[model samples]
Target: MSNVLLLFDKMGQRDIVTWNTMITQLVKTGDVDLAYKMFVEMPERNVRSWTAMISGFVQCGKPKEAISLFTKMEETCLKPNEVTVVAILAACADSGFLDLGSKIHESSDNNGFTRNTHICNTLIDMYIKCGCLEAALDVFEGMKEQTVVTYSAMIQGLAIHGQGEKSLKLFFEMIQTGMKPNGITFIGLLNACSHMGLTNEGLGFFTTMTNDYEIVPAIEHYGCMVDLFSRAGLLHEAHDFIKEMPIKPNAAIWGALLGGCKVHKNIEMAEVAMRHLQELDPFNDGYYVVLANIYSEAKRWEDAARVRKLMKNRGLNKTRAWSSIAVKGMVHEFVAGDDSHSLSMEIFEKWNELLVQMRLKGYVPNTSVILLDVDEMEKEKFLSRHSEKLALAFGLINTRPGETIRIFKNLRVCEDCHASFKLISEIVGREIVVRDRNRFHCFKNGTCSCSDYW
Candidate 1:
């Protein structure tokens, strides 16, 4: 980025395109704060400039900032174009801001911009991301001319919601219309199958993707395959598949296999995955954490301790799990044992009440997943203060009883929390949707959408 800046200084005058390109690249590189610095220093702002910054903020996980930037852009003379609408819709999608997303759709209509395929597809994606599957279906049905991307978005939406069969049916419909599927389409299809444990169907789709469609498998495609096999406890097949891949497997591929190992408790395969992961990404704490967790799970105390010691020696620490909930356009963040909010006391009080209720509902903490060598009671205590639980407590305290509670978790929901949420959702008589790093878990009536599989 500094080299690009030096190149910029060499130019007598830089155009908006040059500035926008630099800003966009910086944002993509995870330097949004630096991108903002460049954005503010621009001589003049256009729709592109505002849109770039808004999109950058969203990509940086600052959806509220993106919306703020969009509002500021509206106050100016320039009307928001299709590109600007797509960026803001993405922000709305990431935050599950359905009401605000509707406003964006209406804004496009008011601006007299043509409802092109790109904008319409983005709308589909936004609705899906916000957990409004019916609304996404409505948008997909309303489109006049749909592209492969449109189908891909709809497929991904269904897949995430555990509607693998519906997504497959749609794939058939898409091909019947004589449109060839692309890499994105197959990724969505395979992911749908993977998440739903439709192993046979997923493998079938994988074969069809490469043999029939002639889409040379990308690393992402291989990752999905590994995930599908690994989640099914077929550790040997997944390992062999990784070895036989035409292209060399990367960290993501190994990570997917490792995740499966974690789920299936395959200590040997987890060790193999960790060895490759260490070579590929030496600084990533996740590999070490998972390897240690596998040892802890197996009651291999000395091995787990050694892994933790190695992590400390290498100056690597586990990433803190964080979660946030949006209520009435305001987002509240919570980390494990968090007490920083103004309603911290009230939140804990509500949490205590929840614990009593959870106990009455026969909730037993799953201590096997603690990953720490501690007493069972201490393990339970630590689990109670997890980020998702705190966020859920805060959501229950603030939101209406009948409203759906949506929380975003930065990591996979812990085993104990996942079990606890099942009871909490039934006891509270409200739908609770937790979007974790893996997939959306909609807890309703004492059951999770994952069906104890994930």
Candidate 2:
């Protein structure tokens, strides 16, 4: 940090590019506060200066602030170029600011900026994150030229939307264009396969990614393979794949296996995954919760208790799940049982009514996921208060008929909630796209894109 400041001091007269570079370096080094200071102190600020600050804010988990800066930049004389457009689009995507993203898309589409492939790619990504898969496809198809990034983003967006076959077709099209699939491209391909439970196809892609493209697998690629095998109920092969990884397996690999263990009720392998997880990521409280949940699902009461006790001993606490839904340009956030929103009473009442309708439609709450040995009625009420349900209720009451409801969650949607969303979609006669931690689940007519496999 001091070296950066010292180098800046040595410059006789700093140009806009020099100031932008130093500020960008500061942001890259996790000195966002210092970068902001430099941004404020710069004598002449260009589009890059504003862009560096906006991207810095986005990368530092302040998407709203980044959007605010972009808004302020609009009043300036300097029009945003491709780099600036991409940076602001990222903020819009992360913030679930669909309206704002569209506005930026409109702005970029003018002034010949959309001709830049990076801007087009960012547009596709923004539409995807906003739960507008159709718009994402339009951007992908309308691009006059596509780079690996353009194809990679489209592939990943399709995979997340559970359009695995489409992603695979696009991957081949990308290859036919003579654009070699890089590690990210293969990650997208593997992810598409994993979500669809195509274990053999995933393996074939992994082999081709290495042997044909000569692209060495990174930890992310390895993690995708682990997820692929694990999601297919191939616990033994997933474990073996981790064992044979050229690089040492990270916590993600073990975490993927743990998730599989949860799905398959493989307590024995869950324990093995937990052992590595605790050693590699001791501070991560989520792993302990997963282990405890696995034990709880298996009816191993003592084991579940032991894991919770271990968490307590290690001074770890399970973080409450949080979720948010953006309606019309405003974001509504909720935690479990927090009735703090202005429309709290309305949301709760609507939730109660929806629960009744769900019950009438033969929707029974899957209480096994509760992990707490409570009465069935109590478990039902508790499950009803999950953040995803609250967001769903809000969307159901607020959105117009036949409009899609998109909810973003910080945690993985529980199985109980997953089932509820499937039914909820059918009951409301609306499509619901839930973007949880790992992937997107599009629920329509009582079925999910994941097919209840997740």
Candidate 3:
């Protein structure tokens, strides 16, 4: 490190590529702050230096900082190249700065970077990550030439947005274009089929990927297949599929099967899945939580209690759930009844109002998930203090009337919270889009797009 700093001191008339190499080395070594300092200290900065710094910021989880730097670069009369635009647009997408992303798109065209396939592919990925599927499709269609990367990005975007049919169509088009699909392409296609419950299609794709495309299924591909068969109520087939996997099933594969078992209320299969899950991840609270829920659903209180005791004996505890909302360009995260925020009083009052409105609208608290030894009223309090509701209330308080609210949760949307979001959407006359760990839930008028299947 000192030798590199000494080299920097002795540098004379270094060009853009020289500075870029230094910046890339620093960024790759996880010295983003130092890299930014070098970027500011450079006497003759170019597009490569700017792009390297911006990519560093994005990689280091400082997307907002990357945006600020990009804006500074623009103000300094430096024309951003295709690489710069792609890196900055990725920052915008990751930060959920949709308006800023749009500006970047416009700027790309204004600066003649829009025609670059690399930039266009990045744009497509950005729009998809921002949940603007229509905009993604628009960018895709507007492209003069599409490459394999383009197809993969669009298909991934569509699959993630729950547009499975569109994703499959594009996959076929990619094949028709005579572009060989890579491993990522197969993963996206299989995931689309899984999300849409296309079991036969997914199975065929899995086979074709191996036999026809010579692409061996990785653990992720097998995980998607497990999810597909499991979600389709083919418990036995799903179990057998896992057994037949070339690679040994990992926690994710078994976890997918366990989730499906919970959905289908298959105690036998759930137990089988749990055995594998426990062996793979004995300390994961998710396994204990899911097994407990299964026992609860089956009215096996003793079994549920035994699992809880096992968790306690192993010194394992449930993770505190949290939710976050982006409001006024700031993300506000909340835990269950967290009172540490500066505006806690106001947030609490708004939450009470929301509770009243939801109750009046026939919202009933789902107390079954609160497995603690508590009374009905206590369970009700726990349900009301859930992190999702708190974050939703915060969004409602900060945003203008009728504006949509988007919240992200770290875990699955509990049954009670799902119902609450539906009621909150109707009571406030606003749309609430909650992205849970597994899927997206768009609630409006007391109805969820997933129809409570998730």
Best by lDDT: 2
Deviation (Å) of 335 in candidate 2? 1.0
Comparing 2 and 3 by TM-score, which wins? 2
lDDT of 1 by residue, 1-454 (tens): 7888789879998898888988888888999998999999998888888888998998888988998888788788788778888889999888777777888887776775536888888889887787777778987998888899999999988888777789889999999999999999999999988887888989999999989999998999999999999998889999999999999999999999999998989998999999999899988998899889888999999999999899999999999989988888777889987888899888888878988988887877788878788898998878878999999989999988889898888889988999889999998999988888888888999998878777
What is the Cα-based TM-score of model 2?
A: 0.94
**Each prediction's TM-score versus the true structure:** 0.91, 0.94, 0.84
What's the lDDT for all of these models?
0.87, 0.89, 0.84
RMSD of each: 2.8, 2.2, 3.5
**Candidate 3 local Cα displacement, residue 375, angstroms:** 1.8
Task: Kindly list the per-residue Cα lDDT of model 3 for residues 153-179, writing each as its tens digit.
Answer: 888777766678889999999899899
Off by over 4 Å in 2: 3-22, 40-46, 75-78
Clashes of 2: 0
- Predicted candidate 2 versus true structure: per-residue lDDT over 1-454, tens digit per residue: 7876898899898889889999899999998998999899998788889999999999998998898888888888778878788888999889888888998888777788888888888899999998899999998889888888889999999999989999999998888888888999999999999999999899999899889989988999999989988888999999999998878999999999999998888999999999999899998999999889888888889999999999999999998898999887788899987788888899899988988988998888888878898899998878889998899888888889998898999999998899888888888899999999888899999999877766
lDDT comparison, 2 vs 3, better candidate: 2
